[model samples]
Target: MRARHGGPAFRRLILEDPACGFDARDARVTHNNPNEEHGRLLEACAAGDHGALQTLYRLEGARLLGVVQRIVQDRALAEDIIHDAFVNIWTKAHTFDAERGSGKTWIFSVARHLALNHVRRQYREVTVDDTTAEQLDAERSLTASAEIEDTFDWQGRGDLDRCLKALEPERRNCLFHAYVDGYSHSEIAERLDRPLGTVKAWIKRSLQSLRECLS
Candidate 1:
């Protein structure tokens, strides 16, 4: 399957109910060598073993969901990404090479990439007028400040990564925290411990720089 976007149906069709005989709690500490076992399970999945896929899900589903949910911040959307990630994992299992990387890492990367793509798509699609942006800023400024990240793993598009790298690290981080991780200006300011206005300025200038470089 081409990693069906439809959630529950695709899961049932390809994965059945993965919870049939496996307890997620048991999968956690059952193996002496998780990396090796994960590799074997992925190999089985490549050879058409649906049960192996289920085992993999039982083992890693919670963690994958956690990783994705942190990025997208929506329970429903995070669940959707997990479903799609598994579909891609199943279809692409044959392409996995254990020598190059661990199966666990590979699986997480699939989910993370999907989540990041969703966030970026949403950011690109949202067009806020200056008034709307200011309104959002005002609202955020009033709310109690919460902790957030100063930076994240940067995944830029094509030459965009080079452009991002050329900018100051703090500026690059401001952009990533805003666009990639979907943090608000207030949140970014709290995380970076800079003034909210400073965070906003960095983001605006960084975006302009990126556009100029890309254009």
Candidate 2:
């Protein structure tokens, strides 16, 4: 993705530098014709090109981490998603197709969807009597949208940072609450102590503003 945008991991760890097998640019290069290369890589992987799989992992691991990190939040859980993503990519590479989208996109789509689904499915199974627990529950449910949204930093992604940044921090909070924290409008109103209508307006308008700015 567009880099971690200054997460502690990006700054503090020397090992996390994009050059050390975690470059978003490298991922973007393959993403140029993802479906075509995805097929090649998949075929190679299926045919036992361990190096190809490793290339995929090195190129996308951090970006995928950045994407999944936004939704899953917990460092450990985000890492867990990455772990699962690699396994999933390896096993499901055989099923990939160029007609769907670029292979690189599919790789990320598969990884992110699984991570989002993981949190969403788990969120539905919990009890919710206390407000604290309920918020926690709601937070867990906040995950990746079904599509790979233009929300976070995607390498060479459409210009969205300035738009997302134009919003007030609290207004932005609603976006994260829905996309990252998985809270509903009513839940967000309750949490923020504003009118539900106001919260809803903020989210809708925020999205509109973002789309306009990007467009």
Candidate 3:
């Protein structure tokens, strides 16, 4: 980023500017593209260009909701979480650092972490019995999969999809549970009624297959 106080100079180093006062080397930079478009969006946001935020919301809102809904498992609750996520996005827009992460990634991370935090905090210790867990899991999985495209079909990311294709539809539940439903390994086991060992194997092998395929 490049704005002196606020413009393209800000684009070149807004993350490092004293007024912004954040690090140019914040850790998220390692994970995604920290390009100038993010800087432009942040600038637009700071200038009260609501249209900029709306455009971002339009681009990301459906997928973000899909992700959040998968985790929270309640429509009203997920909507509430999305609402909070947008509020956070608006308030924190000025704090975004192009050197830290891509604006798109940053936006998704905010929404995802909010959903994760809510479910983690509220339902962390609630243990359903084995039989009911399995039934509810089946019903929820079917309902969710039927109506939603949760796994991102992930075009052009290389071997991730190819590896995913290797697994049986049901076995893919392991990845879906973690990536989409935010379930832990134990939760996946309980929900799938597969032994914990089996679920663990599926996920381990699935990741291995993905890595090798990508390689």
Question: Local distance difference test, per candidate?
Answer: 0.74, 0.66, 0.66
Model 1 lDDT tens row, 1-215: 01213356534555345566644443433565898888888898899988788889988999999888878776767887899999999999999999989998898888888987876655443344645555556755557356543366675545477787778777778877765455667667777766566567668888898888888
TM-score of 2: 0.50
Off by over 4 Å in 2: 1-35, 125-215
Per-candidate TM vs. native? 0.53, 0.50, 0.56
Residue 83 shift from truth in candidate 2, angstroms: 1.0
Which regions of candidate 1 fall more than 4 Å away from where they truly are? 1-30, 125-215
Query: What is every candidate's alpha-carbon RMSD to the true fold?
Result: 9.8, 11.2, 14.5
Residue pairs with colliding backbones in model 2 are: 2-153, 2-154, 34-102, 34-103, 35-102, 35-103, 142-182
lDDT of 3 by residue, 5-36 (tens): 12354235423324754232322222233455
Question: Residue 113's C-alpha lDDT in candidate 2?
Answer: 88
lDDT, model 1, position 81:
86
TM-score of 3: 0.56
